[model samples]
Target: MEYKYNKNEKTAYQKGYRVTKEGIVIGKKKNPVGWLHTNGYRRFKIRDHEGKNRNVGVHRLQAYQKYGEKLYQEGYMVRHLDNDCTNNHYDNIDIGTASQNAHDVESERRKERAIHASSFIKKHNHEEVKAFHEKYGSYKKTMEHFNISSKGTLSYILNKES
Candidate 1:
């Protein structure tokens, strides 16, 4: 839950460091090999004296320190482009907004939906959605006759124009 760090706890082996809390050792210190054992699950999660999670693996910490302020200002989270969540190397990380971050996971699907919805909104609402449909006949004919994108964002445009 919490790892207590102190000056005296610093050791000769950089990774061979363990923090404690309430006089109890949280986890065994790890050696360099053991630290990067290629195991998917890490044996220990480095915690701060207060129990907050702060990844202190030299690489991760350096990344956080380097881009923390800039990311905070843009309201973006630093993401690992490699899709390896554990790899915090500076080269692999990028700053992204919440929507942009979500895009990383399902960008293609979202893009397709945006493009289609834009036309559907403009066409259907003008066609079958109103008396205009009687004059226009059908939605597809209306779409072919006009060429609107999606039907979803029509309200937004109408509101802005008003």
Candidate 2:
């Protein structure tokens, strides 16, 4: 889905921080110092140049300005495309249904599995998988012996490499 951003949004340079409409929080000469909130979103709390301490989620601040306050309506969630909540860039944030967010999470997990599988094969080779299977007698046990998940990825590696 196409994400929309406000072109008119300007970065606010408050006392020690610069907050962008895309939800980036930079501090102390434009350095990234965004902290993860307890709710798992990136946030910033600082005394703006005006000497007022402001604490808020970068996504909420941007979403409110980009999509408006009504964007907080029921059943809608702000999703990070990369699945890293700390990366609260405006382009990374999207308004999605709960199910859509869950689907994105699953997609990221699959990508992580592919990455892990490729790295493991690169480091150890497929013979290790074959040897584990021979010793354990089953694909599931082989996975346990190797300390990995994604049996499907393991099978693919075995087939393609062997």
Candidate 3:
């Protein structure tokens, strides 16, 4: 995964078109490019050898500037340590395998799912579910009485109350 920069890119890098510690790309004049991709990563417009404008991720540029080509060798990618795509700060970035990056994203997704499930569960009457379970002394009967679809949901509601 070693990235070979074209002449234009190399020239830009040499001319002070560099990413800062904050993940902003600073041009030769020392002004921020201030452009961001829709996916939340900062982007820089660099002209290719063909003179066509191409967008590059600021994190990639930062990784290259900091760690050089060694970071990209053998399928390694730039990773956000805090799982924040927009936080391109030098200390918040790392070089890792695709699986490591995927694991970070998956961990974030699991947290989001848990938060959503917790909020959804709060919309239900936990006290009523607990009382009904106690009265029936059976999870199946309590779920049936509450019209709950998942036994796990019933268990969660009953257990969460305690």
Q: What is the lDDT of residue 5 in candidate 1?
A: 40
Candidate 2 vs. truth: CA RMSD? 10.9
Q: Please give the CA lDDT of all the candidate structures.
A: 0.42, 0.63, 0.71
Q: Write the per-residue lDDT of candidate 3 for residues 27-79, one digit (tens) a residue.
A: 87888885777878877787765677877777777777878756657777789
Better of 1 and 3 by lDDT: 3
lDDT of 2 by residue, 45-125 (tens): 665445666666676556555676355566676677777777767777777786576566666576666667757655565
lDDT value for model 2: 0.63
The positional error of residue 39 in candidate 3, measured at the CA in angstroms, is: 2.0
Deviation in Å, model 3, residue 68 alpha carbon: 0.2
Model 3 misplacement above 4 A: 1-11, 106-108, 111-162
Error of 3 at 130 (Å): 34
Instruction: Supply every candidate's count of residue pairs whose N, Cα or C atoms clash at under 3 angstroms.
Output: 11, 3, 0
Clashing residue pairs for model 3: none
Using lDDT, give the best candidate's number: 3
RMSD of every candidate to native, in Å, equals: 13.7, 10.9, 10.2
Per-candidate TM-score against the hidden true structure: 0.34, 0.42, 0.59
Q: Which ten residues in a row have the lowest lDDT in candidate 3?
A: 1-10
